[model samples]
Target: MKRARTIAWIKGLVAIVVTAVVFLVPFAFVLLQAAKTPDDASNLTFSWPTHWQFFQNLRDVLATNDGLIWRAFANSAILTVGSVTIMVILAAMVGYVLQRKASRLNPVINFFVLAGLIVPPAVVPTIWLLQGVGLFKTMFGMILVEATFGLSFCILLFRAFVGTIPRELDEAAVLDGAGPIRLFFRVILPLLRPVIVTVIVVQAVAVFNDFAGPLYFLPGDENATVQLTLYQFQGQNLSFYNLLFMDILLITIPPLVAYIFFNRQIVAGLTSGAVKG
Candidate 1:
């Protein structure tokens, strides 16, 4: 039996090693490609370059139209931060209320939230709705849309994590003359730090790397985000693989750097959803 368990452990180790390689190799190839020049990029995406052209590529990608990469980066930062801030706060509040104070209507509300998970938003209708409110193709409009899309997951995560918080704390706070605001912000919310960090890390990433919504809803040169900047890089007539690779690398770096930094929370936040029951 001990020998059989040893063989199973070895198999698990080999499986993990293979899984790591499967994800890491392609990423390494992209990194190597991004570090190379036009000559090296054209010859072999996986090969070592004669000279490091990463600085040139980085500079060129960020220096378009004399200096548009920084503008796009700034735009990305705005959208990411704005969208995430709204998503985290609203989702957390709604989740807390829904989970803590269940009502006969909660099942209905939960169904609607669940619909957000399954149903794709009607883009044209959404645009029309926003335009009716005089917000179409605007920064705030896009931020709202990002928040709306992100809310479902954030709410779900908060609901799961909130379940782990003892209701007795909320009771104690209320008995001590604490109102709803005080109870949430001072008492219950701090306990939610771990899950909030998780949600922020996850949703921030989604907001940062978003493409389609920015592509269709917020289309304009003035509002071109990191993903949308690629549209300019790729032209109708001719495409430059070398420049495109550089654009990809520039856009990829923020998210990649973020993942490396918050990778632990990313895993914890995702896995913690299973902790409540």
Candidate 2:
């Protein structure tokens, strides 16, 4: 028993060390670098700043480019919220149908969903399609791109969680005169809060931080998302490492806070239906 306790203690300590190195160290380094002056940040070491200038860095980052950073934040917020909302609702409905409804087309639909997960998006064709629809270079276009990329994962998560929900509830609700839409919204959606929150936090963070999608789909200063604001601190000749780290620090706070607060929900949702078999 004593030997077992020792092994467990060692494992726990190792886990803590790994977590600190992987997450905490990088976070602390960014915070420290963002606090340093231009020359100090140039050194790029982990030492404490001679002058703590976190607030100044923030002000500079926000005020740079006539406050383009704030505009990027607004754009990211709208894109993240819109895409996540649409994807979650659609994923829920589709997942529920796939899980509950039996049909010959179920396998075909499942194959397509899995294909969506496996296949890389054809960017050029997608651009052509969006342009044809007159959505190219627009915020709505960006949202759709983010939503499409994130849908497969969200649907898989929701489908797993929905599987754990008993079919008796559905039958009872339907017998109570609820139609398909009413049954899902009124009865089923309430039970899916855990997975729904998980999807929201995960997808929101991903979509908000996404650089490539916004760059490819919405290519304009006016349509810049938060991730694109990183370019403001970089140039062909000189790069503002201090302000760059500061911009990173600012954009990172929201997702960090979100993960910290909703971590349990994320874990719960991901692990929700594991033992159902």
TM-score of each predicted structure versus truth: 0.90, 0.97
Candidate 2 achieves a global lDDT of 0.93
Mind giving the per-residue lDDT tens digits that candidate 1 earns over 84-172? 88988888899899889969999998999999999997988998898899988888999999999989989998888888887899999
| Top candidate by lDDT | 2
lDDT of 2 by residue, 178-209 (tens): 99999999999999999999999999999988
- Whole-model lDDT values for every prediction: 0.82, 0.93
Flag regions of model 1 displaced more than 4 Å.
1-16, 39-45, 50-52
**Candidate number achieving the greatest TM-score relative to the actual structure:** 2
- What are the per-model numbers of colliding residue pairs? 0, 0
Q: What's the distance in Å from true for residue 19, model 2?
A: 0.7
Model 1: per-residue Cα lDDT at residue 43: 69
